[model samples]
Target chain A: MERGTQPVIKARVHVGLKAGVLDPQGKAVEHSLHALGFAGVHGVRTAKSFDLVLDETDPGKARTTVEAMCQQLLANTVIETYRIDIEG
Target chain B: MERGTQPVIKARVHVGLKAGVLDPQGKAVEHSLHALGFAGVHGVRTAKSFDLVLDETDPGKARTTVEAMCQQLLANTVIETYRIDIEG
Candidate 1:
Protein backbone atom coordinates (compact mmCIF):
# COMPACT_ATOMS: atom_id res chain seq x y z
CA MET A 1 0.00 0.00 0.00
CA GLU A 2 2.92 2.33 -0.66
CA ARG A 3 3.66 4.44 -3.71
CA GLY A 4 7.29 3.94 -5.05
CA THR A 5 7.65 0.53 -3.48
CA GLN A 6 9.40 -2.16 -5.50
CA PRO A 7 7.11 -5.05 -6.26
CA VAL A 8 8.14 -8.64 -5.64
CA ILE A 9 10.69 -10.35 -7.91
CA LYS A 10 9.77 -13.34 -10.06
CA ALA A 11 11.56 -16.36 -11.56
CA ARG A 12 10.67 -18.76 -14.34
CA VAL A 13 11.29 -22.48 -14.21
CA HIS A 14 11.56 -24.65 -17.34
CA VAL A 15 11.19 -28.39 -16.85
CA GLY A 16 11.21 -31.05 -19.56
CA LEU A 17 12.10 -34.64 -20.37
CA LYS A 18 15.76 -35.42 -20.92
CA ALA A 19 17.14 -36.72 -24.17
CA GLY A 20 16.86 -40.52 -24.64
CA VAL A 21 13.23 -40.79 -23.55
CA LEU A 22 10.70 -41.66 -26.21
CA ASP A 23 8.97 -38.48 -27.38
CA PRO A 24 6.03 -39.14 -29.62
CA GLN A 25 5.27 -35.43 -29.87
CA GLY A 26 8.80 -34.73 -30.97
CA LYS A 27 8.65 -37.58 -33.44
CA ALA A 28 5.49 -36.08 -34.89
CA VAL A 29 7.21 -32.74 -35.12
CA GLU A 30 10.10 -34.30 -36.95
CA HIS A 31 7.73 -35.91 -39.39
CA SER A 32 5.99 -32.60 -39.92
CA LEU A 33 9.32 -30.91 -40.47
CA HIS A 34 10.10 -33.36 -43.23
CA ALA A 35 6.65 -32.90 -44.70
CA LEU A 36 7.13 -29.14 -44.53
CA GLY A 37 10.23 -29.54 -46.73
CA PHE A 38 12.82 -29.06 -44.00
CA ALA A 39 15.14 -31.76 -45.22
CA GLY A 40 18.05 -30.75 -42.99
CA VAL A 41 16.07 -31.59 -39.88
CA HIS A 42 17.24 -35.01 -38.85
CA GLY A 43 15.86 -35.35 -35.28
CA VAL A 44 13.39 -33.31 -33.27
CA ARG A 45 12.38 -33.05 -29.63
CA THR A 46 10.09 -30.73 -27.63
CA ALA A 47 9.98 -29.29 -24.11
CA LYS A 48 7.79 -27.03 -21.89
CA SER A 49 8.31 -23.89 -19.81
CA PHE A 50 6.67 -22.28 -16.76
CA ASP A 51 6.53 -18.81 -15.23
CA LEU A 52 6.54 -18.16 -11.48
CA VAL A 53 6.44 -15.16 -9.12
CA LEU A 54 7.84 -15.35 -5.64
CA ASP A 55 8.17 -12.98 -2.71
CA GLU A 56 11.86 -12.75 -2.04
CA THR A 57 14.38 -9.97 -1.36
CA ASP A 58 17.64 -11.58 -2.51
CA PRO A 59 18.22 -13.01 -5.95
CA GLY A 60 20.86 -15.55 -4.90
CA LYS A 61 18.74 -16.84 -2.06
CA ALA A 62 15.77 -16.87 -4.35
CA ARG A 63 17.65 -19.04 -6.84
CA THR A 64 18.70 -21.50 -4.16
CA THR A 65 15.22 -21.64 -2.75
CA VAL A 66 13.77 -22.15 -6.19
CA GLU A 67 16.20 -25.01 -6.83
CA ALA A 68 14.92 -26.66 -3.68
CA MET A 69 11.39 -26.07 -4.85
CA CYS A 70 12.16 -27.78 -8.13
CA GLN A 71 13.88 -30.73 -6.49
CA GLN A 72 11.22 -31.34 -3.85
CA LEU A 73 7.94 -30.05 -5.24
CA LEU A 74 8.11 -29.46 -8.96
CA ALA A 75 10.22 -32.10 -10.78
CA ASN A 76 10.35 -35.87 -10.61
CA THR A 77 14.03 -36.80 -10.67
CA VAL A 78 13.28 -40.37 -11.68
CA ILE A 79 11.57 -39.59 -14.99
CA GLU A 80 12.11 -35.88 -15.66
CA THR A 81 14.68 -33.12 -15.07
CA TYR A 82 14.32 -29.36 -14.66
CA ARG A 83 16.26 -26.09 -14.83
CA ILE A 84 15.54 -22.68 -13.26
CA ASP A 85 16.25 -19.28 -14.76
CA ILE A 86 15.67 -16.09 -12.75
CA GLU A 87 14.68 -12.74 -14.21
CA GLY A 88 13.94 -9.50 -12.45
CA MET B 1 22.98 -56.37 -40.97
CA GLU B 2 22.98 -57.76 -37.44
CA ARG B 3 20.42 -60.05 -35.83
CA GLY B 4 20.94 -58.92 -32.22
CA THR B 5 21.85 -55.27 -31.97
CA GLN B 6 21.17 -52.90 -29.05
CA PRO B 7 18.40 -50.45 -29.65
CA VAL B 8 19.20 -46.76 -29.63
CA ILE B 9 18.93 -44.86 -26.35
CA LYS B 10 16.63 -41.88 -25.75
CA ALA B 11 16.49 -38.80 -23.56
CA ARG B 12 13.79 -36.48 -22.26
CA VAL B 13 13.77 -32.74 -21.84
CA HIS B 14 11.70 -30.68 -19.39
CA VAL B 15 11.34 -26.94 -19.79
CA GLY B 16 9.30 -24.44 -17.74
CA LEU B 17 9.12 -20.89 -16.46
CA LYS B 18 10.97 -19.64 -13.41
CA ALA B 19 9.19 -19.13 -10.12
CA GLY B 20 8.95 -15.36 -10.38
CA VAL B 21 7.29 -15.32 -13.76
CA LEU B 22 3.50 -15.33 -14.05
CA ASP B 23 1.88 -18.62 -15.06
CA PRO B 24 -1.82 -18.55 -15.87
CA GLN B 25 -2.10 -22.33 -15.97
CA GLY B 26 -0.51 -22.54 -12.56
CA LYS B 27 -2.91 -19.92 -11.29
CA ALA B 28 -5.83 -21.99 -12.49
CA VAL B 29 -4.44 -25.02 -10.69
CA GLU B 30 -4.06 -23.00 -7.52
CA HIS B 31 -7.64 -21.82 -7.79
CA SER B 32 -8.84 -25.37 -8.24
CA LEU B 33 -6.84 -26.46 -5.21
CA HIS B 34 -8.53 -23.82 -3.12
CA ALA B 35 -11.93 -24.68 -4.54
CA LEU B 36 -11.34 -28.28 -3.56
CA GLY B 37 -10.85 -27.12 0.05
CA PHE B 38 -7.11 -27.70 -0.06
CA ALA B 39 -5.93 -24.76 1.97
CA GLY B 40 -2.28 -23.70 2.48
CA VAL B 41 -1.60 -23.75 -1.23
CA HIS B 42 -0.20 -20.26 -1.71
CA GLY B 43 1.24 -20.43 -5.21
CA VAL B 44 1.17 -22.85 -8.12
CA ARG B 45 3.19 -22.97 -11.34
CA THR B 46 2.84 -25.16 -14.42
CA ALA B 47 5.50 -26.68 -16.68
CA LYS B 48 5.80 -29.12 -19.61
CA SER B 49 7.94 -32.17 -20.31
CA PHE B 50 9.13 -33.95 -23.46
CA ASP B 51 10.62 -37.34 -24.31
CA LEU B 52 13.36 -37.84 -26.89
CA VAL B 53 15.07 -40.83 -28.49
CA LEU B 54 18.50 -40.40 -30.04
CA ASP B 55 20.82 -42.78 -31.83
CA GLU B 56 24.03 -42.17 -29.94
CA THR B 57 26.73 -44.63 -28.96
CA ASP B 58 27.82 -42.94 -25.75
CA PRO B 59 25.54 -41.50 -23.08
CA GLY B 60 27.98 -38.83 -21.90
CA LYS B 61 28.51 -37.57 -25.42
CA ALA B 62 24.79 -37.68 -25.95
CA ARG B 63 24.22 -35.45 -22.93
CA THR B 64 26.80 -32.93 -24.05
CA THR B 65 25.40 -32.92 -27.55
CA VAL B 66 21.87 -32.52 -26.19
CA GLU B 67 22.95 -29.52 -24.11
CA ALA B 68 24.12 -27.89 -27.27
CA MET B 69 20.84 -28.83 -28.87
CA CYS B 70 18.92 -27.10 -26.07
CA GLN B 71 21.01 -23.97 -26.30
CA GLN B 72 20.72 -23.79 -30.06
CA LEU B 73 17.35 -25.25 -31.05
CA LEU B 74 15.06 -26.00 -28.14
CA ALA B 75 14.99 -22.93 -25.85
CA ASN B 76 15.01 -19.18 -26.16
CA THR B 77 17.25 -17.80 -23.42
CA VAL B 78 15.68 -14.37 -23.66
CA ILE B 79 12.19 -15.39 -22.48
CA GLU B 80 12.27 -19.11 -21.81
CA THR B 81 14.48 -21.63 -19.95
CA TYR B 82 15.12 -25.36 -20.36
CA ARG B 83 16.89 -28.40 -18.83
CA ILE B 84 18.03 -31.77 -20.18
CA ASP B 85 17.93 -35.16 -18.48
CA ILE B 86 19.48 -38.21 -20.13
CA GLU B 87 18.26 -41.78 -19.84
CA GLY B 88 19.35 -45.04 -21.39
Candidate 2:
Protein backbone atom coordinates (compact mmCIF):
# COMPACT_ATOMS: atom_id res chain seq x y z
CA MET A 1 0.00 0.00 0.00
CA GLU A 2 1.05 3.57 -0.60
CA ARG A 3 2.35 5.38 2.43
CA GLY A 4 -0.38 8.04 2.71
CA THR A 5 -3.24 6.10 1.16
CA GLN A 6 -4.07 4.02 4.20
CA PRO A 7 -4.35 4.65 7.92
CA VAL A 8 -0.96 4.49 9.56
CA ILE A 9 -0.42 1.66 12.02
CA LYS A 10 2.51 1.78 14.40
CA ALA A 11 4.28 -1.36 15.52
CA ARG A 12 6.74 -1.42 18.34
CA VAL A 13 8.93 -4.42 18.98
CA HIS A 14 11.14 -5.07 21.98
CA VAL A 15 14.02 -7.57 22.20
CA GLY A 16 16.13 -8.22 25.19
CA LEU A 17 18.78 -10.49 26.66
CA LYS A 18 17.27 -13.69 27.93
CA ALA A 19 17.70 -14.88 31.47
CA GLY A 20 20.94 -16.82 32.19
CA VAL A 21 22.69 -14.97 29.39
CA LEU A 22 25.75 -12.93 30.17
CA ASP A 23 25.47 -9.21 29.49
CA PRO A 24 28.65 -7.34 30.18
CA GLN A 25 27.15 -4.08 29.04
CA GLY A 26 24.19 -4.43 31.38
CA LYS A 27 26.54 -5.27 34.20
CA ALA A 28 28.54 -2.16 33.51
CA VAL A 29 25.37 -0.08 33.52
CA GLU A 30 24.29 -1.61 36.79
CA HIS A 31 27.64 -0.69 38.25
CA SER A 32 27.29 2.83 36.98
CA LEU A 33 23.80 3.14 38.44
CA HIS A 34 25.01 1.90 41.79
CA ALA A 35 27.85 4.35 41.71
CA LEU A 36 25.35 7.07 40.86
CA GLY A 37 23.53 6.29 44.12
CA PHE A 38 20.65 4.30 42.74
CA ALA A 39 20.02 1.78 45.47
CA GLY A 40 17.75 -1.26 45.63
CA VAL A 41 18.63 -2.15 42.06
CA HIS A 42 19.32 -5.81 42.03
CA GLY A 43 19.84 -6.75 38.39
CA VAL A 44 19.88 -4.82 35.16
CA ARG A 45 19.10 -6.39 31.80
CA THR A 46 19.17 -4.49 28.53
CA ALA A 47 16.61 -4.55 25.74
CA LYS A 48 15.74 -2.86 22.41
CA SER A 49 12.64 -1.46 20.74
CA PHE A 50 11.57 -0.79 17.17
CA ASP A 51 8.82 1.60 16.02
CA LEU A 52 7.43 0.80 12.58
CA VAL A 53 4.73 2.59 10.62
CA LEU A 54 2.64 0.39 8.37
CA ASP A 55 -0.67 0.54 6.53
CA GLU A 56 -3.68 -0.42 8.60
CA THR A 57 -4.65 -4.06 8.08
CA ASP A 58 -5.63 -7.25 9.89
CA PRO A 59 -4.05 -7.27 13.33
CA GLY A 60 -3.55 -11.01 13.36
CA LYS A 61 -1.87 -11.03 9.99
CA ALA A 62 0.23 -8.04 10.89
CA ARG A 63 1.28 -9.73 14.10
CA THR A 64 2.26 -12.85 12.24
CA THR A 65 4.30 -10.82 9.80
CA VAL A 66 6.06 -9.06 12.62
CA GLU A 67 6.76 -12.31 14.45
CA ALA A 68 8.34 -13.64 11.30
CA MET A 69 10.36 -10.49 10.91
CA CYS A 70 11.60 -10.86 14.44
CA GLN A 71 12.54 -14.49 13.98
CA GLN A 72 14.19 -13.92 10.63
CA LEU A 73 15.95 -10.62 11.14
CA LEU A 74 15.12 -8.62 14.23
CA ALA A 75 16.04 -10.87 17.14
CA ASN A 76 18.59 -13.48 18.15
CA THR A 77 16.50 -16.26 19.64
CA VAL A 78 19.60 -17.83 21.06
CA ILE A 79 20.23 -14.94 23.43
CA GLU A 80 17.29 -12.56 23.17
CA THR A 81 13.47 -12.40 23.30
CA TYR A 82 10.97 -10.23 21.41
CA ARG A 83 7.45 -8.76 21.67
CA ILE A 84 5.32 -6.64 19.33
CA ASP A 85 2.74 -3.85 19.63
CA ILE A 86 0.53 -2.38 16.91
CA GLU A 87 -1.47 0.84 17.13
CA GLY A 88 -3.43 2.98 14.76
CA MET B 1 -2.28 -2.76 41.51
CA GLU B 2 -2.08 -6.47 42.07
CA ARG B 3 -1.03 -8.60 39.11
CA GLY B 4 -4.40 -10.24 38.51
CA THR B 5 -6.50 -7.26 39.58
CA GLN B 6 -5.52 -4.99 36.74
CA PRO B 7 -5.77 -5.64 33.04
CA VAL B 8 -2.44 -6.73 31.65
CA ILE B 9 -0.91 -4.24 29.25
CA LYS B 10 1.87 -5.50 27.02
CA ALA B 11 4.63 -3.08 26.05
CA ARG B 12 7.18 -3.91 23.40
CA VAL B 13 10.35 -1.93 22.92
CA HIS B 14 12.81 -2.15 19.99
CA VAL B 15 16.32 -0.75 20.02
CA GLY B 16 18.69 -0.68 17.11
CA LEU B 17 21.98 0.67 15.84
CA LYS B 18 21.58 4.13 14.45
CA ALA B 19 22.89 5.14 11.06
CA GLY B 20 26.68 5.60 10.91
CA VAL B 21 27.01 3.34 13.93
CA LEU B 22 29.31 0.35 13.80
CA ASP B 23 27.72 -3.07 14.29
CA PRO B 24 30.07 -6.01 14.03
CA GLN B 25 27.33 -8.44 14.99
CA GLY B 26 25.05 -7.05 12.32
CA LYS B 27 27.81 -7.30 9.77
CA ALA B 28 28.34 -10.94 10.66
CA VAL B 29 24.63 -11.62 10.26
CA GLU B 30 24.59 -9.89 6.92
CA HIS B 31 27.45 -12.04 5.75
CA SER B 32 25.67 -15.16 6.91
CA LEU B 33 22.46 -14.17 5.18
CA HIS B 34 24.38 -13.49 1.98
CA ALA B 35 26.02 -16.87 2.19
CA LEU B 36 22.58 -18.37 2.65
CA GLY B 37 21.58 -16.88 -0.75
CA PHE B 38 19.55 -13.91 0.48
CA ALA B 39 20.44 -11.36 -2.15
CA GLY B 40 19.34 -7.72 -2.45
CA VAL B 41 20.15 -7.31 1.24
CA HIS B 42 22.68 -4.52 1.37
CA GLY B 43 23.19 -3.22 4.87
CA VAL B 44 22.12 -5.03 8.01
CA ARG B 45 21.67 -3.32 11.34
CA THR B 46 20.93 -5.33 14.44
CA ALA B 47 18.31 -4.32 16.99
CA LYS B 48 16.71 -5.48 20.27
CA SER B 49 13.16 -5.64 21.66
CA PHE B 50 11.44 -5.98 25.02
CA ASP B 51 8.01 -7.37 25.96
CA LEU B 52 6.60 -5.84 29.11
CA VAL B 53 3.39 -6.64 31.00
CA LEU B 54 2.09 -3.71 33.01
CA ASP B 55 -0.99 -2.71 34.96
CA GLU B 56 -3.59 -0.91 32.91
CA THR B 57 -3.89 2.83 33.35
CA ASP B 58 -3.65 6.06 31.36
CA PRO B 59 -1.80 5.39 28.13
CA GLY B 60 -0.16 8.78 27.98
CA LYS B 61 1.16 8.37 31.48
CA ALA B 62 2.26 4.85 30.77
CA ARG B 63 4.12 6.02 27.68
CA THR B 64 5.85 8.74 29.61
CA THR B 65 6.94 6.28 32.26
CA VAL B 66 8.19 3.92 29.58
CA GLU B 67 10.05 6.67 27.80
CA ALA B 68 11.78 7.47 31.02
CA MET B 69 12.60 3.83 31.50
CA CYS B 70 14.09 3.70 28.03
CA GLN B 71 16.14 6.82 28.52
CA GLN B 72 17.33 5.86 31.95
CA LEU B 73 17.80 2.14 31.65
CA LEU B 74 16.44 0.31 28.62
CA ALA B 75 18.38 1.94 25.79
CA ASN B 76 21.76 3.43 25.26
CA THR B 77 21.09 6.81 23.72
CA VAL B 78 24.72 6.95 22.71
CA ILE B 79 24.29 4.26 20.07
CA GLU B 80 20.80 2.81 20.20
CA THR B 81 17.24 4.06 19.62
CA TYR B 82 14.11 2.72 21.29
CA ARG B 83 10.36 2.60 20.57
CA ILE B 84 7.56 1.51 22.95
CA ASP B 85 4.22 -0.23 22.32
CA ILE B 86 1.43 -0.82 24.84
CA GLU B 87 -1.40 -3.25 24.26
CA GLY B 88 -4.16 -4.55 26.48
Docking class of 1: incorrect
Give stretches of model 1 more than 4 Å off. A1-6, B1-24, B29-88
Predicted structure with the largest lDDT when compared to the true one:
2
| Number of the top DockQ candidate | 1
Residue A78 of model 1 has an lDDT of 74
Error of 2 at B43 (Å): 17
**With candidate 1 superimposed using the best TM-score fit, by how many Å does residue B87's alpha carbon deviate from the native?**
24
Measured against the true chain A, the candidates' chain A TM-scores are: 0.72, 0.81
Model 2: interface root-mean-square deviation in Å: 7.2
| Poorest 10 consecutive residues by lDDT, candidate 1 chain A | A1-10
